[model samples]
Target: MAIKTWELDSNFKNEIAAMPGGEGIMKCFQCSTCTVGCPITELEPSYNPRKIIQMSLLGMKKEVLESEEIWLCAVCQTCSERCPQDVRISDLMGAIRRIAEKEAEEGKIELKGVRAIFEKAFMHQLEKFGRMYEIGLSMEYYKKAHGGFFAGMMAMQKDYQKLGMRFFKKGKMGPKSMFPDKIKRTGEVKKIFEKVGE
Candidate 1:
């Protein structure tokens, strides 16, 4: 990929530091501790939280916000726990996620592919039902991800059938879960979401 010219916006690091989980980002000094401890790196060699942080610090706004790698973070705190500088790499990832979502929402950039849809669908399900509806989230995300409900269903048919059979045999799959279940204090849950503006 061609590198984008860095713009005059050198405030990315400071902006991230001001975010809720990003306070420790400024203390990093190219230490590799975070990368060495991040389990995601073992699974996906292309994803390195350290590299992502360096990109943000270097003011690579477009690359930082648009790369699917940012969304790949599992939010496991291994990186933060292992960091010698206490940069809180997981928290920095959260800050980057917030910025990316904001940029997409504001039309500063277009979010292509399934990651954005999946995140929104997951959040919507969580907010509405106060819990995860796996089937519902899958349906919603795949519909948007595949650009059509039918395509999504077709693609996920086998996996759904397999999991469905397993759950049914184990007596775990039930109609109640297929339907969205609201907790006793769903209102309170909604309020919490409102407070967080999620």
Candidate 2:
């Protein structure tokens, strides 16, 4: 579909550049270095960092914000390491995601995938325990992903039954794993979350 003229927001790039890790966005010069080095691009041809940057520079605000391509970046930083202009493409992707998330939260747009859900679940576990709690993380992920506790449990069982059994046999997961003691510095962890307004 062709983009309408009014859909463009000339200030969009500047808005992103103002965000942390986004300051280098304008340094990009359409060099394909980032795209060339992007592991995701090799696996998924539709995920083009160079194209995303060019769109952003061209003020394709809505397209860039709502595109699933932004979420495909794995943040492995190969692109950042290879960028001759030091665009920090991995960090740039993160800045874009942050904006997308903000827009989603404000009801301005809908996110199309489970990545945001999984991220919230993961962060909730981290914030609560000051470290990862796999059982809790799994439960939370399924609950949000599938919509409820019972449904999540059923889905989890169907998906992980064999793996769960193996983990149990290897003492990797069990009843005791369900209620791990929170880390000693959990308060410190909460403070960090507070500082970030998470």
Give each model's whole-structure lDDT: 0.83, 0.89
Per-residue lDDT for 1-198 in model 1, tens only? 555655635798888999999898878898788888778899998988888888888888877888888888888789888888988888888888888889999989765446778888999888888988888899998888887989999877855889888898888987766787766777888898899886
Clashing pairs in 1: none
RMSD values, in order shown: 2.0, 1.6
Clashes of 2: 0
The candidate that wins on TM-score is 2
TM-score of model 2 vs. true structure: 0.93
Residue pairs clashing, model 2: none
Query: All candidates' TM-scores?
Result: 0.90, 0.93
Cα deviation of 59, candidate 2, in Å = 1.5
